[model samples]
Target chain A: MEPIIKVENFTFYYPDSQVPALAGINLTVQAGEFLGLTGPTGAGKTTLALALNGIIPNFQGGRMGGRVMVAGLDTAKTPCARLAGVIGSVFQDPEAQLVAEVVEDELAFGLENLAVPREEMRQRIGAALEMVGIASLRHRSLRELSGGQKQKVAIAAAVALRPRVLVLDEPTSELDPRGTLEIVALLQRLNRDYGITILLIEQKISVLAPRVPRLVCLNKGRIVADASPRQILAQEKLTTELGLEVPPVTALFRMLRRAGVYHGDLPLEVDEGQRELGRLLGSRASRA
Target chain B: MPGKSFLHKLNPLTKVVWSLAVITLAFVYQEPLPILSLWASVLAVALIGKVLREILPAIRGLIIFAAIFFLFQVFLIDEGQVVFTLVPGTGIGRITDVGLKACTMLALRMLAMTSTIPVLLATTPPKDMIVAFVEKLKVPYVYALMLVTSLRFIPTLQEELSLVIQAQRAWAYDLEGRNIIKRFLALIPLALPLLLMSVQRARTMAISMETRAFGAGPRTSLHTSTFQLLDIGVISSCLLLTAVLAVVSLR
Candidate 1:
């Protein structure tokens, strides 16, 4: 797969900060890949997400080094307006990001900024809202929306331009478990069905682990681990020391393996764990 | 508060002009009768718009303020004939008839002026108000967005403010201090966190807008406010009313 986003030896420092927020970071995301980004607080995850959308060095004035390219355009060279059509960014708080009073207008916000023709904008707004399952909320006021619906509207706003990549920074952090699951499932469908690349920044490993194939962990302004979600979660010592919350299932299997009860491979889901345990119990019963 | 009514359907710009005209005409007369009649007219408009119930709470507060203003005028100007004397000997305690009349007119004028704003705002959505400013008045989009976003966050900020107040109270802070200065000092804790939170929210909101390509170039809107026949009728009536008030005041 060709890399749509490439960051080479990137380093960035905010004004008045002693140390760089993103230090010597090198990463790449292939076209149409759903990648999960996880880390402890202040681990440069948000900084990296900002860099992808050209928000870091473009809107945020800071000392910077090295390069980030999205869809063949250098982020440093491209204005955020130009990059916006290629990379849609949904921030953490849906409330702060909403610029319109109604859902339909909110979805049309990016298209309007890009000056999409009215005919095309109407189609895109309708299609985007439908894509996010918020078509029914078209005329509803933002004040009347639930938090989950608002976040969905926010996502719809970003995707209205049909961007190739969507970068969501902690999109589910403020949501309840059901809301979080709804958003995560929607993201999964967007990636799998629509072929849109996703970079999801999340604190909950369990929520992110099942949906995304690849997981990249950042720590102290550096990429510490880059592998499949199962591989990253299997590094029990590293993840624990990095202050990441280990998925409960992954942790339980690891503890069972250490106690010498049953071991084959780590399970990331309940059904997989149940199968593994059933097999172990059967084999031990036959031996006894 | 959100409803479909004659006033609500009027173009936001027309409503704005209507309110301005009513307020300006309220100041045209120094007589109590004209001011009170204008106030009645404003109340009637509010009733027609079906926002009278919603606007009454704010109007009730202004009535108390106007009463205080009337009383202050009754004692301050002692030049006219005495209406009454509280302490027969003390000249300061005397009520003058001229003071009572002038103050009554002033109080009514103030009430009329204050009433028009609630009538305008209670019927118009803040979003539509900003949209009209941008579309009709040709205000810059950035300023209009600022106005709309600030208005949208008002309720959220209020909620956050009360949360901070509750947090301070939880810390055993003396929020109910009897001394005015001490009570004022108690607000520092509430104000500082709210300021910090607002600043942080503003920063995030800026980034969110930038990422969406806001301010990149001239923008188009999904919502376009257009002046209709009703708007023209409403605006023309306001112009006629203002002209008649000007002529009547001059005569």
Candidate 2:
């Protein structure tokens, strides 16, 4: 299948700054792919997220180089409204992304803009709310929510659009650990079950990189590492050297294997770690 | 939770229609009793709805306006028998009965005009009211939904602005300053950021609303707001009140 989004030599410079936010970056996001973007703050993670939705050239006045196409439509040519169905974007700040007071209405906002049939809109709102585990908050005001609940509602709003690719820009950074887990679980469900592509931009790779297979590391607005998590995590010097932290389990597995504790392969998730540990313990028991 | 208020149980459409009737009748009566009655009813509603708490602070703004209005009418109106002429022996001294009458009517009319609003705001959720308005009055659903969304966004923006103001003042922007002009000038410093932020919110909401196919056609109401028997009885009694007054006036 054709790539849903293609970025070729994309560079961006803010109006006030002399330096570019993104420097000649090239990337491709295909349908149904869960891609994790990792970098430190001010590393153009958000700038890259904006380019996928045509917000860079249209909303933010900035210097642009090369081409960014979303769902075969040129980001340069397609209006922001036109990109609604193709790219769903959630911002870093939940408050900035919220428009309606009520949860149901917030979910209905983008559907209303697309002029969807009213019943379908309601259905999508209901489905999205259910998907995000926020159906119980339908009547509550947006301001009444905790930061995590609000982010869930924000994600629900994006999912209601039913876009092929969903881009979340540090959606959980402002949230607590519990909130982070809730959002990551929901995102995993979306990517795994619904077959929706997800482009997640976040700094806390320990939380996200394990779930997504692909990882893109950025430094000074350039893609310094474009590889799977297993490959990327092996280069400990490159990771910490570039100010990025490797996932805890990956680091733990590397440490255990180095010390000859017992390891066949590096496990990414907790379950994977549990299974590996269970096998090692079983082998020791049998030998004894 | 359903709001606990006498007026809260009454339909918003009933309040709107009845208050409109009261407003129309307020114009015809020469007696202060009916005008006072209208004011009293509004206050009762406001009190029952717990809107009185909000009225105090929000209407600190309307006090100066009321005073200015009191002064303007106290001098400008020159009708009927004179009591205290504005000039005195020069022909404009003591206030006239007509002036006082006019002033009483004007003040009471203004008060009564806003009376229902507090009750409306205090008891009815803006979303429920908008849905009711659309369902009851045959307003196009899209427009009503837009209006509902706008009202929904209103409180969000207000809260955000108040927060921004407080945060700025906490950082020594002096938003708590009492000077009228300085406070007014202080608003200028905050307006741009608020507008920019609000616009961004609106754009996001618009997208969120559209992607679900929100306005493709006539949609079913997840909310059903119907007038209860009490609402009907209330509206009927208000209609009777207006009719009785009109009859009394004709006689």
Pick by lDDT: which candidate is best?
1
DockQ top scorer: 1
lDDT of 1 by residue, B101-178 (tens): 988988999999889888888888777777788888999887887777888889989989989988888898888989
Worst 10 residues of 1 chain A by lDDT: A241-250
lDDT score, candidate 2: 0.78
Candidate 2: tens digits of C-alpha lDDT, residues B35-59: 7787777777677666787776545
Cα deviation at B116, candidate 1, in Å, is 1.3
What is each candidate's DockQ, to 2 decimals?
0.69, 0.21
Candidate 1, A110-198: lDDT as tens digits: 88888888788999999998899888899899989988999999999988988899999999888999999999999988998899999
